[model samples]
Target chain A: MELLVASAIGVIMAAGVYLLLRARTLPVVLGLTLVTYAVNLFLFVTGRLTVDQAPVLNQGHESFADPLPQALVLTAIVISFGMTAVIVVMALKSYVESDSDHVDLDPQDDGEADS
Target chain B: MNHWIILPLLLPALVAPLIALAVRHDIVLQRIFSVSSTVILLVLGAILMGSTASDPVQSYHLGNWIAPFGIVLVLDRLSAMLLVLTAGLGLAVLLYAINGWDAEGRHFHPLFQFQLMGINGAFLTGDLFNLFVFFEVLLIASYGLMVHAGGAARMKAGVQYVTINLVGSGLFLIGVGLIYSVTGTLNMAHLATEVGRVDAADRALLEIGGLLLLLVFAVKAALVPVQFWLPGTYANAPPPVAALFAIMTKVGAYAIIRVYTLIFGDDAGASANLAGPWLLPAALVTMVIGMAGVLAARRLGEAVAFAVIGSMGTLLAAVSVFTQEAMAAALYYLLHSTIAGGALFLIVDLVNQRRTGYTDWLRAAPPFVHTGFIAALFLLGAMAMTGMPPLSGFIGKLLVLDGVRESSYAVWIWGLILGTSLLAIVGFARAGTTVFWKSAAVGGYLEPARPLAPALPFVAVGILLGASIVLTAFAGPVTVYLDTVAEQIYNPSGYIETVLPTSGHPEGVRP
Candidate 1:
């Protein structure tokens, strides 16, 4: 279970990074979404993987998954969702203003010299 | 549990919603609420600072829940001081914004208030996860403000800024998760107690987690290798928003000081001074690169932005030592740099507003009305930024240099800080001369597109510069206060006990 979760997280994060490096804003937004997903999963498993266990303490339950990470994941999900919405709107706005989808302000002058 | 500790967060949170909902369409009403709330915040902050002066660390657990189980807001001399600074800066920037900058966009007042709430929350939160939440709050508010008066350039820069910060947010969560997994606690006070007892096997994970967190703070602080986003964002952001952002980077610095000194300081058995080794070198490099950028900038606003980065480098170098004297000096430098950087941004805006054709560009232009007064303000701002005598910047640098003199890296610290000051002086001089002095040879006065008073902006600039002068004049008492602040920072027993008065371990949960 740990291997499955950890590998899934690694693969998702790698894909996120790849998408993040793309020159278009949509891909970057998608990349951020993917990264957030991976983070949520990573946070979910931080309490150690447990199946068929209550997240909170119960008299009948001898084992329980840590509930704090679950709460943390919930908050992370909400924030990431809101942020994704914000970025999408911003990207669309930038596209309309510059009339270009490429992330750089001037695609022709894309170099490290000026920045 | 002094209720005042929570007011800094509550007042802005409540006022922001009121402005957004009740007065969304009324700029006048929005400004009135925003400005009044900020004034109250400043007063509240001063009260908190005074309270902490007598009683250092005070923690307020939400819902009266015990520590480690519930979210907590820890108020200390550090948080109180930052709260006051944020409110003061917010008020000045709010005034300058209402002077006409707010009209450029809708919802400026709400967003400004929300930004203040986030900053104050970040300063006051005692839990790592809560800090992340506040960071998001601020970043979200800043995004709205960043592109508030949107142009093509500003919007594009805004997109880039949002992307980088999203990536940073991901890293932040990963760091917090790693730390939580090992320590089984996210409360900073609880983590401080737990960090030392981690198994030998888990120490590496904890260290990696700590360093990852450092990277996140470094990104926010605009430390080297992660500072690429600052110049573009600051230059493109509306001057008033950029001025408020002067406190944002300091948020990162504040977090570094808080987390490192309290959680990973000398008491942590295996991870003692976890950030010390990496911080100094990166800080020195940050100084060099920032000054070089200042020298190379083609626009006045961009130059000031780079100067901010340089100042952060200087401030962090002092903090890297972790000694009370050095931390005191770092706090003073932090206060000085925020005011100076904020003033310079405002001054650049004034210059931009006046120039006929080239707004804030470094080339000579036709003279404008009030050139002498605006130029004089710019000169004083530049002097403070470049650490010239008779201003707070000079005193800040001297304190930093003297504080770090006993360290092994003294030679490097001395050499880099001194060299960078020279670089900054030259850079500011060249920009000032081209903008103010060389413009005298140009043909005509820059006629106004509209009749302008610019009284509020000048007043705003004057208030900030006056604060800098006050910092210089009262350096003695200020340093004495900062000495206690630093002393409280290094000795976290007071903080830890206040946050978690019972068992060192959190009793309610298990991992």
Candidate 2:
């Protein structure tokens, strides 16, 4: 179970990072989404993997899955959702306004390598 | 009483969208809303500061939910101090902005109101999720305001600024997720406790989390490597917009102090905030870079922006040293930089207007604007920025260096003391020589009739400058309060008790 979840997170992270590194803005946004998924799962795993325990308290369950990480992950999901909306708007704005999603041909940043 | 914390948060969220009604009107309604909301915020912050100043902890459960279940707003000396800064600066800027930046009343009011809301939100939020929300509000409002006049220059800079901050926002989300996974509670005080139970091997994840948080703060604070985006963005922003922006960098400084002292202060053996190695070196570099940029910048606004970055670097460097006095020094310096820097920008805009929009420092400024009195204030303001005495900036620098001296890190202390003072002198001289030393040779910029000249902008400028001088007189008492604030931050046991009374041991997962 741990192996399966860990591998899943790794794959998700790999995919997101690849997209983030893309030249255009849309792919970078997508990359961020995938990264969010991995990060969420990775955070969930830190509470240590629990097979059957829901964070909710029931009559006879011996140990509860840690409620703290559960609560935090839920909050993370909400904030991430807001973040995704922001990035989408940012990309769309960049696309409409500049007609390109590439990072500004920054005068200061890329000069050393290009020269 | 905990609900009073909500006032700062609630006022902007409620008032922000409604600001559009002032669009067609003159600056009157805009002034009322911006000034009133910010002044109320300042008063509320003062009360919160007083309430928490001597106490160890105070908590307000949102909607009456207990900690570990519902979201909470925690107040300690550190949070209270930051709240005062965020609110006080918000009011001052709003005040200056009313007449100074309100030349075109159309869109400035709404955007200014929204940005203040965002800043206040960042200061007040105890939950990590809300921090991101406030950042979005601030950044989005900034984007609109940056290009409010819709010029190509402003728009171009806005694109880069928005894009980079989005990247920063993304990193922040990932960080929160990682931290939540490890600690379980979103309440900062609770997370501090939960974070300690994890074994040393798992600490790297926390370090990454710490780094990401630091990354966001560093980007905003405009520290060394991530700092390049700040100058272009700030320089092109409209005048009043630039004055408001003067306080924005300090928000990042505030967060760095809060997070370091609260979240990562203790996690000693293995699981530190990853702040140690990078911060000191980076801070030194940031200051040096600031000095270098100031020297190199041809445009007046750009020089001011670069100088602002260097002052922030000095503050951050003090923070990285992580001693009580060092923190106080950083705190004092943060306030000094915000006031002096903000005043300088307002003056820049004023002088630029007089020059009829030539912001190049080396270009001859309009002669009608620089009477001996005005020139004298400009020189004195420059001196204050450089830490010369009988002025506010000097005293603040003394406290910080004194803190450094006590730490006994002789070389770095000497480096910060001598290096910062020397670079400050160089940067100020470079910009001032171009700006004030020579009288304007113009048939170029027209002379205005003596009595018919602009009165209001200079009045606003005088108020801002006078406020800074007053701070110098009260410096002794203020430094003591700041020292106490520093102690609360470094040892946040008092902080923990205020938030979660049952949680005995102090744990530092985050601030």
Query: Best TM-score goes to which candidate?
Result: 1
Local distance difference test, each candidate: 0.92, 0.71
B1-511 per-residue lDDT for model 1 (tens digits): 6998899889989999999999889888988999999999999999999898678899998999988888899999999999999999888888788888898888898899889999999999999999999999999999999999888889999999999998999999999999998988999998998899888899998999999999999999999989999999999999989999999999999999999999999999999999999999999999999998899988988899999999999999999988999999999999999999999999988887777567788877778878989889999999999999989999999999999988999999999999999999999999999889987897677875556655888899999999999999999999999999999998899999989965555553553
* TM-score for chain B in model 1: 0.99
Over B345-436, each residue of candidate 2 has an lDDT whose tens digit, in order, gives 77776666555334444555545445455667677677777788878888877877777775546477558656767777787787776566
Worst-scoring 10-residue span by lDDT in model 1 chain B = B502-511
DockQ of each: 0.49, 0.17
Worst 10 residues of 2 chain B by lDDT: B444-453
| Cα error, candidate 2, residue B323 (Å) | 1.2
TM-scores of all candidate predictions against the true structure: 0.98, 0.86
Highest lDDT among the candidates is held by which one?
A: 1
Clashing pairs in 2: A43-B181, A68-B184, A69-B184, B57-B498, B263-B510
Off by over 4 Å in 2: A1-57, A62-102, A105-115, B21-27, B53-56, B100-107, B267-274, B365-374, B441-444, B447-454, B503-511
